[model samples]
Target chain A: MSAREEVLARLRAARDVGGSTVPDVPRDYHRTGVHAPGSAAAVERLTETLTDYRATVHRVGDLDGVPAAIAAVLAGSSSVVAPPGLPGEWLGEVTATVRRDDPPLSVADLDRLDAVVTGAAVAIADTGTFVLDALAPDQGRRAISLVPDHHVCVIRAADVVSSVPEALARLAPDGPLTFVSGPSATSDIELDRVEGVHGPRRLDVVLIVPPRA
Target chain B: MTTDLGMPTVASDPHGHLRGTEPFPVAAHRALADTQLRQNLGHATRTIRAKRAAVVGEVDDWEELRRAGECVKADVMARLPELLEQLEASVTARGGVVHWARDAEEANRIVVGLVRETGSDEVVKVKSMATQETGLNEALGAAGIAALETDLAELIVQLSDDKPSHFLVPAIHRNRSEIRDIFLREMPDVDPDLTDEPRRLAMAARAHLRRKFLSARVGISGVNFAVADTGTISVVESEGNGRMCLTLPDTLITVMGVEKVVPTWSDLEVFLQLLPRSSTGERMNPYTSSWSGVTPGDGPQTFHLVLLDNGRSNVLASPDGRQALHCIRCSACLNVCPVYERTGGHAYGSIYPGPIGAVLSPQLTGIDGPDDVNASLPYASSLCGACFDACPVRIDIPHLLVQQRAAAVEAHGRPTAQDLAMRAAAAAMASPGRFSLTERVVKLGRLLSRSGRIRSVPGPGAAAWFGARDMPEPPAETFREWWGRRERS
Candidate 1:
């Protein structure tokens, strides 16, 4: 018999046997009863986790104040790359040269750009991870968020989840979800860490609080 | 490309050239003696282990996640053929092509053919064990295609022409100065005067690979997990090199082991949480890129998934041994293994070295081989259970190791002088009358010893143990002797 047939037969045989018990994967995350503790509480936990990884976290009270917040952080930068789907209202305060995430931008040009502000598809509260799908409107090409010196990912409280299982349920299988826990870092040397080896050097998470209903 | 016949075969005993009778002790002595390698391994592993612990601890459902990860893997293994067919259909529907390789030779041929068809003489590679096990780079090089390793540590090893020493951190054996020297010597157009500083070395590598990233027409990668439900493959890495390789090329060829398959996208949650923390000691990797087939004008225009089965099916056959297939290649078992800590990975003979290699290598290749290296792999471990405990999949490595040892002994035929001694021991153990007779004889010999311990004994049995360690003196009397004396009194 062919090796392929042998493997298929073995897989079938192993499956037929009831020797090993199946392990429990987390399908019922809600049964855990871990409440959100409110959006402010969730943001606080996120800030703590982000700071633990040494990333800078900032908060904006309202959407109108977002542009000013962005300007304050990127004050000296003349050019800012906005994700194609980025809300223009957030960039209203910035009077400097703004670069929209265009397809032609090379890795070198993206490196030269001042900053990028893109909305995340989901913010994992448990892991402090932000998922960016390429299809997401404001999040330009993945290279834009990855190559730039500074990345300001915008996360809304409602998108935040308490566990990885919860976050996985919200994501589409075919969609591209670039899970970013923190800025790029590596300890390839004699156990000495060097950040920004290939990705963003500075990660500035802009937590946009939902407006009071 | 035509050198398939020349590739080392199992019976040739390739790694035996580097091994000795004192395999573990010799390798461990050298590794432990190297203060630099020891310090580097210690610190690197501790940091990653700690990060994994912290991130893994954050979620109360982590145990559940681990269980889920195991179950999903088990499920896939059970329904592998059906799921693979489903996956093939899905991939084909999305304009992606699939190829099946029965073994390393077949896998290499398919990859070489694919790269040749792309008409590219060079291809960028993301770190993948499937490629390594097949010796794909060497095959590609022989085929006249330059396979460039994009992962930082892999790049260092590639530049130095060295084999990987660790699973996750391939260059764990090398220090910063070694890396700098390699960069200075091997990198084309690299500055002659480069410092051993981490930042400088990274920048130099970055500058070197940026060109490859932009110009390469074909990209080769290994997937951490393939979501059978969506026909999606996930590549997680700290460096954006993977992202570049996955996105920049027109044609992307992913070589994945059949074991990497998962039932659904939801299964990714269990592994995404398990892998990052376990391998890199991070809450999440810097980049977790998942692409399905080909994207229109965005990522690769053409995608090929090479489902590799070099020796995985053989491993999946044994009841106890099949659990070894569940390994995620996290290198957690290696880090915590006392044996691996001393010998490093090179001693294992196969591309996969360490505790996982001990059971895996022999099974992958049929056990009916004359190679001393394949025979020696099962004995490499101390059966301390440390590896099994450290394994993310919880493979009972010790159980498999013992089973492999039995298989090895059986393969070698009935009994050598050592086997006869063990058989004699079994006989003595089975009959109390013979056991007492042997005990009395041993006790009578103890009269000559000044101390309770015997410094040495004269026999073939003594040679194996006394070769490395001092033999302890025999006790003045056996527990049976004492019990007899008590009853008489």
Candidate 2:
């Protein structure tokens, strides 16, 4: 028998012998938090959680506020890269050399950039996590956000979710997803968390909340 | 670059890092003698324990989440065969080739062949417990392929030719200065002024592995969770090495234990919430990359998923023992364990260590005899029940430990001296007169002790006790006798 067949057979025998007890998955855990999605309370909680992990979060008022927010965090950056779908006006205030990822940037090309700007697919308020879908025109490829030292993620109001389950619902299984909470960190050294490692060391989240309805 | 720890043997499949060089007690004895190991383990575990407590405390529904997590894992275990088939099909539909291996040797053979086919002599790796379990790096090395461990702690262990002592931080046994020394001695073209500061050390590693990450042709990692419906593979890590290895490499080969497969994409919500908080005490880890098979032009063009069923089926066959397969390799149990805190990871002698390893390793390879090295594992725990509380999946580790201990005793065939002694003591305790007489006899040890602690006992069963610790002085009177005197008064 093929290895696959034999292995499956073994598992079947084990399940049979163990008297396959189909377990009931109790989903009573809080699927949603106290705050509603995209609510001011949710965004505030997002900011608090992101800042708690040492990521600088900027609460921007609509699309016009995004470019300045992105630029402010990229003050000392020499070069910046963003997806082709990112509005050119978003980098209008930035002095850094701009390279839009129309043609996907090589890893070596990405390494030279000081900062990366990309729009997120979804943001989770409870965990302060944002999902980056590589297939998404705004998010571009996974490497662009990762290789650069600084990552400036623009999270629009519509994209914010209240919790993890909500975030998963918004994301597709494909698109090669990356869930980033904060900048790269390691607790490997004496289990003491020191932020900054191989990934973007400085993460700046631009919250583009709409004007009060 | 593994240490020369002896392989645990059951004769059927004698591979993987499930067993250590010697029995747990003998290895633990040596581990107990090392003050440095103790201090390192003590500090690291305590630091993580506090961090975990704080983060876990933030969740109002943490217990509810744990119950969901446990039941989901149980469901996965019960229906593993079907779930695996669905996973294989989904992954195949998305342009991944699925390979199954009955044991470690087959798994290694399949991986080495894939790497050889990629024609890459070197591969960068994310920290993976599955590969470590199968000793894939050693197998790759023997096949003339250099597998560089990209995670900082794993790199330290790999560089020094040491074994991982902890699940998350492989080099938790080594202090910062020791790491600097290792880097200085081993890392070529390293800066002479590199200090023991963690950030500096992390920067040094970033500089070292950057080129390899950028250029590596093949990458190997273990799956944290494989969504059976979506065929998505997830790798959770604090450092971006996981991102580097997962994205940059053209050909990605992931070795996943069969038990890692989850039924659906939504299952990840529970795990994603449970894992980081439970493992590193983060609301969410720094990076969690999920790819369903191959993602064309975006990440690795080619992907391979090797499903390993080394000893997991054996663990699953036994109803009570099946909970061992529910482990997500969080190492939360380890960080909170008293025995693990004292002896560190090395004493368990397996790649897996701590409270989880005690029940897990022995079951992975059945206890062969009374003296089998893995047999001694069930006895390694003090069974404080902290491991159960700390476990995100709520694996009753103490229950499993006692179960494994029973299996060990049964595996011993004829009654051992300890078994006989317990049986005899039980017999005496069943009779009121004999119970009093037995208590009187136990109190006789006080006569031979000057310091009220028995240093030695001239008997067959006493050697194992006296070798490590003193026997406490018996009470002056039994409770029954004291009750009788009080009634008379």
Candidate 3:
């Protein structure tokens, strides 16, 4: 028989003999919740976990106060990096110089930018991780969210899920998805934890609660 | 169809010598004698084990996440061929190339040729188990190309010329002082004065590796997952070095095991949560990089994915044994294994070590006689279920270990002495008459000691039992004989 045929035979034999057995899941892995908590509860949980990881979280009750919140975080920054698809309402809160990430910005320009603000694709309520697909209007080239020292991400309560399985069911297949659990951190140096080795130093989560219907 | 990172999977079998064609007793004996190694392993494993337990306990849903991870891997393995073809189609459509290998030689050749085409002598690497298993670094060295290990622990191991002692911490067998000595000796153009302080050592390494990072044109890596639904390869790491290697280079080559595929991008959720908690004892790792084929202006323009088999198909053959492939390389099992705590990873003699290694090595490269340590690998574990409990994939490792041992015994045709002992034991056990005779003979020994302990014994049993532990002596009178006498009275 040919090598290919031999491989095929072996694979066929393996399939025939190696019948599938359902792997034993631990009995105590109870994730079933009859009433999925509302978006507000999820946002609250996200903020709590985010802060627990030492990330700075800001709360904006309305779009009107967003600029103040962004400005307060930026304090006297020379310029702000903004994605081309960023919502106008989101940036009305920031007073810093706005530089769109769409244009070819020099390394010096990126370094000078105080921070970048964008929306997440999915936010896991279980682990409080935010997913960015670069498809969001405000989320620019992957590098923009990554290279900047500070990153501010907006999350709606409706996008939150109780667990990763629930989150996986929500993410789309044909897009760029970047899951941000917390600010970039490393423990490579003798297991002594350090923050912002390559990515953002400060991560601010803006848990925007939609008005009651 | 190109970005930056150069392809270094071009080198053939960079780690070839590690396959363990040597005898297990010899390898294990040498490893056990290293006092420094024992101290290093004992300390390193204990520390990681405690941290993992503490972090894992904090999350109530850890078991659920582990189950999800295991199920997803099983599903992928079941539908692997179709998923792989789909992955290839998606990658090819997005302007990426895919290469297939049946074994280590084929894989090495494909990678080496690719690197030779890049016309580069050095390549940066992410810590990839696939490369380690295939011996890609050694292969690269043979081809006169240097494979620079960028992961901190891996870098330390490479500089010291020692094998990785643990899955997660490669230099787990080295203490701070040893690491400092290795750096001072091996590091090119080092400062005259170097302290044993970790931060200072890290700074030195950073300074040392910074030039390699900037200068290297090619990068080789292994993926944590390759999403078939979207045609993207993903890497999850604690260090941003993975990102630098993934991004800055001109050509990129990723060697992925067939078992690392997931059916959809959505499935990443299960693994994202599982890998971090199990691996680094964290809620989430810092950097997770995913790229599909190639993009016009960002990341590596020339992308090549080498689909490695190397004996995974053989593993997928056994009924109970196939579950070994579901492991996520989290190293949680190693951290919890008591046997692994003492003997360490080097004793296993495979790139994949610990409980996973016990079952996996025998299957991958069959249970061979004479110079094969892989056969004896099954005996390295104490059959404790800690590995199974700690396993993120929930592989029933003890069951597999027993199964492998059975296969080994059958293959070796059984030792004559063991066969004779088993026959005698069975005969004694089957008949009450023969058993009573043996009991009567042992009754005199109980007269010597009132204590429920045996000081020593004579013959083969004595030698085997007394080697590591003490054995208790026999009783004064047989129960049957005492009963008979009472009935007569």
Q: Per-residue lDDT for B1-489 in model 2, tens only?
A: 112121211213445377887888888889999999899889888999999999999889999999999999999988999999999999999999999988788899999999999899999999998889888898999999999999999999999999998889999999889999999999997899999999999888988888899899999999999999989999999999999999999999999989999999999999999999999888999999999988777889999999998878778888888898899888999998888999989988888898888888888878877777888888888889999999999999999999998889899878877888899989998989999899999888788786778888887877876886787788788788899999999
Q: Model 1: DockQ against the native?
A: 0.42
Against the native complex, each candidate's DockQ, computed on alpha carbons, is 0.42, 0.62, 0.27
Which stretches of model 1 miss by more than 4 angstroms?
Answer: A1-38, A102-114, A210-213, B1-35, B191-193, B369-371, B444-452, B469-471
Scored on chain A only, each candidate's TM-score is 0.81, 0.96, 0.79
lDDT of 1 by residue, B296-380 (tens): 6467888999987665655655666777778888887887777777667765656677888888777776566433456678888
Q: Higher-TM-score candidate among 1 and 2?
A: 2
Reference contacts preserved by each model = 0.42, 0.79, 0.27
Task: Summarize candidate 3's per-residue lDDT along B329-362 as a digit string, tens digits.
Answer: 8888887888787777787777777888778777
Task: List runs of model 2 lying over 4 Å from the truth.
Answer: B1-16, B436-440, B472-489
Each model's lDDT: 0.74, 0.89, 0.72
Best by lDDT: 2
Candidate 1, B145: how far from true, in Å?
Answer: 1.2
| Candidate with better DockQ, 1 vs 2 | 2
Q: For model 2, what is the C-alpha lDDT against the true structure?
A: 0.89
Please tell me which predicted candidate would have the highest TM-score against the true structure.
2
